[model samples]
Target chain A: MTTYYTKSHEWIRLDGEEATVGITAHASEELGELVFVEAKDEGTEVAAGDTAAVVESVKAASDIYAPVAGTLSGFNTKLSDEPTLVGSDAEGEGWIYKMTVSNPDDLKGLLTAEQYKSL
Target chain B: MSDTLHQTPLHALNLELGAKMVPFAGYEMPIQYKAGLMAEHLHTRSSAGLFDVSHMGQLRIAAKSGDVRDAALALETLIPADYAALGVHRQRYGLLTNDEGGIRDDLMVANMGQDLFVVVNASCKHQDADLIEKALGDRCIVTRHFDRALIALQGPEAQNALTSLCPAAADMKFMDAIETELAGVSVTLSRSGYTGEDGYEIGIAAKDAETVARALLAQPQILPIGLGARDSLRLEAGLCLYGNDIDPTTTPIEASLAWAIQKARREGGSREGGYPGADIVLRQAREGVSRKRVGLMAEGRAPVRAGAKLFADAEGTKEIGVVTSGAFGPTVNAPVAMGYVATEFADVDTALFAELRGKFVPVHVRAMPFVAPGFKR
Candidate 1:
């Protein structure tokens, strides 16, 4: 599996035709505490840059954008009861959702970890 | 974003404590610390939290001839509250009104021994000071306390922490103010605060502010809270923020602050119709306003925010009102908000919808003070 990052702060790890997605640790830290999370329903089709999720802290609410065009396969339901997971381990157990890649070529638009860090 | 933002006396202390600094009211102030907004908010409710409110303006309104009643009467011409009936050492919430029946600002006025101590919003301090000077200059002397700093210690354990420093603070009830010494520093301490908690607002000389703040934080029950938690706390308390909840376009009656106006200023009273906009305000108090401010509870976990439009139907076709302040209440464990809606729809249990992210979320009208105030009174 190889991982790619987006400038919007989402990170995706591709495993064959499926991918796991979550926000970067830096993004979670900047958002402070997580009080609520809303993910797109399973099986919903989304395009790149579409708002697929929302995360709310005590101070403000932010939208999490889809990194690439895909069909959402599933989402982590644990976030409904324990949103703080996003703040505790954003890049691990805090994974927001899994999706089936609609077009493998969509990976070309993502940045490598090194390139994302430079931006 | 401006490099010229003013810094409070505790600016260095905040940075040292790992606070996220942001610009507010022309000052670089802390939005939250390392513990984050949620923890900071809950901590203040369970124990005590110290806040830097030095950016607010404090002023002394004194009569040149040394008569306190004369000074109070002079101020009565500008606001609708009955300052003359305000007992000594007691504070009253007041509103500065324009001649057109609009609100200029909301403030706290305390009757000290020989003068009136006034605290105004940070953003409206300069304008308020100028208005007071221009209107009442001949009758009273208005002295702005530009070199003073104000700090608030709020929570259930606030009294315990404050009384430890000044034992006499224990004698004060809510809204009481007294001049006393705290750790050898002369200060005016008031048993009043924006947070709906038992707390004290201490006004001290700017030079001694840092020392006093450090002493308060040294108490085991007290932690430094930032603006983020302070905002959520006040919102849950159902208190209004000046610019957001009550602005120049809002009237006291329309804002559901009719309780702040005593009977002496209303119709059938001896001093009726003396203050600016008294005619319109008094009429509204009797006839009622077309719109009123009310509390709202979101049906789901998603937090609704300010500027969210309101609708009467779930279809979200007819816009009825707009939210002014909204946040996730740490105490209620749900999303709460305050907004202005048509008077007919302001009743408790009224069904409404708040448009968030292009979708309407179900909301119900509810009574304010989402969490019961733990006032010492």
Candidate 2:
């Protein structure tokens, strides 16, 4: 398994064709407290860089874009009642969704952990 | 406006406390701290929250004769409030009205015995001062206090924390403004705030602002809050932001603030219709306005943001109004908003639809003060 990040701040962990995704801690910190989040439903086909979810913080709302094109395999239903999880634990239980990658080549375009850090 | 952003007297202290700075009214102000907006808002509701509101403009209106009543009478020419009847050490919410029967800015006016202590919004202070000087300059002396800082101590435990330093603060009723010393520093303190919480707004010398703010934050029940929580708190409280819910294009009558216009200033009263746009305002008071401000309770968790058009039906036909301010209310735990709607649809519980994203979301006109106010009065 390998993890990659997008310049827009989402992180994706790839396991074969399956992957999990969430925003980075840096993005969560900048967004402040999360109040509401709505993710695309399971089975929805999302393209790379499309808005996979919408997250609202106390200050403003933002879109959580998909890093790679895929079919959403699962949605984080718990976020509806507990959106703050994204800010409290962005990389773990706060994961926004799971998906099946459409093209493995898309992974090569993503940033490494070190590259994401500098961004 | 200049590209250079100004900093308040408490800028360094706010930075030290880990504040997230943002540009507001041309000033770099703290929007939230390390605990974030939700924590700061909830903490304020349960305990006390310290806020640096020094960016607001503070000024004093004094008559050449040294009589506050004379000053009030002169000010009555600009605003439609009964300031002349305002008791000593008492504050009243007021507005600067334009000649066209519109609101220029909202303000707080405290009768300070010899003069009226006025506070205006940060963005409008300069223009407000110029207006007062241009309009009432002959009868009243308008002195802008650029050297003063305003601090707000709000929430449930605010009284207890404030009394710890100024015992007289405990005796002040709501809207009471008194000159008192806190920790040996002189401050013109008012038993008032915008957070719908029982609290006080302390007007102190800019030089002593940091010292006074530090002392207040030192209380066990008090935490430093920022503008993010302040906005949510006021929105929940149903108070209108100067430039948002109310503006130069909106009149007090249309904005549902006619109550602030005392009977003395209304038609057929003793001192009737001396203020600007009095003819139009008085007529509107009697005949009613076409549009009215109403509180909106969004049906779902998604906040209906400002500028969203309101429709009579879900089909997006028949546009009725526009949202001016909306936010996810932390205390209400739901999306709360305020907007203008046709008067016929402005009644409480009237169902309305707000266009959000690309769809019309069902919202209802609800009574304001989403959370019960905690005023000492």
TM-score of 1: 0.97
- In the range B1-377, model 1's lDDT, one tens digit per residue, is 57799888788888988899999999999999888888889999999999998899999999998988889889989988889888889888999998877789999999998999999999999999999999999989999996689999999999899888899989999999888999889999999998899899999998999889888989999999999999999999999999999987888999999888788887887677687788888888889999999999999888889999999999899888999999888888999999999998999999999998878999999998999998877
lDDT tens per residue, model 2, B1-377: 24598888998999999998899988999999988899999999999999999999999998998888999999998999999899999999998998888999999999999899999999999999999988889988999996688999999999999888999999999999989999889999999999999999999998999999999989999999999999999999999998899998999999999998998988888999988888989999999999999999999788988899999999999999999999999999999999999999999999989998778999999999899999988
Query: Model 1, stretches more than 4 Å misplaced?
Result: none
Model 2: clashing residue pairs? none
| Chain A only TM-scores, each candidate in turn | 0.95, 0.94
Query: For model 1, what is the error of residue B99's alpha carbon versus the real structure, in angstroms, after optimal superposition?
Result: 2.1
Q: CAPRI band of model 2? A: medium
**DockQ, per-model, please?**
0.79, 0.67
Q: Determine the C-alpha RMSD for candidate 1 after optimal superposition of all C-alphas.
A: 1.4
RMSD, one per candidate, in order: 1.4, 1.7
Q: Tell me the docking grade of candidate 1.
A: medium
Poorest lDDT segment (10 consecutive residues) of candidate 1 chain B: B269-278
Q: Model-by-model lDDT, in order?
A: 0.90, 0.92
Share of reference contacts kept by candidate 1: 0.70
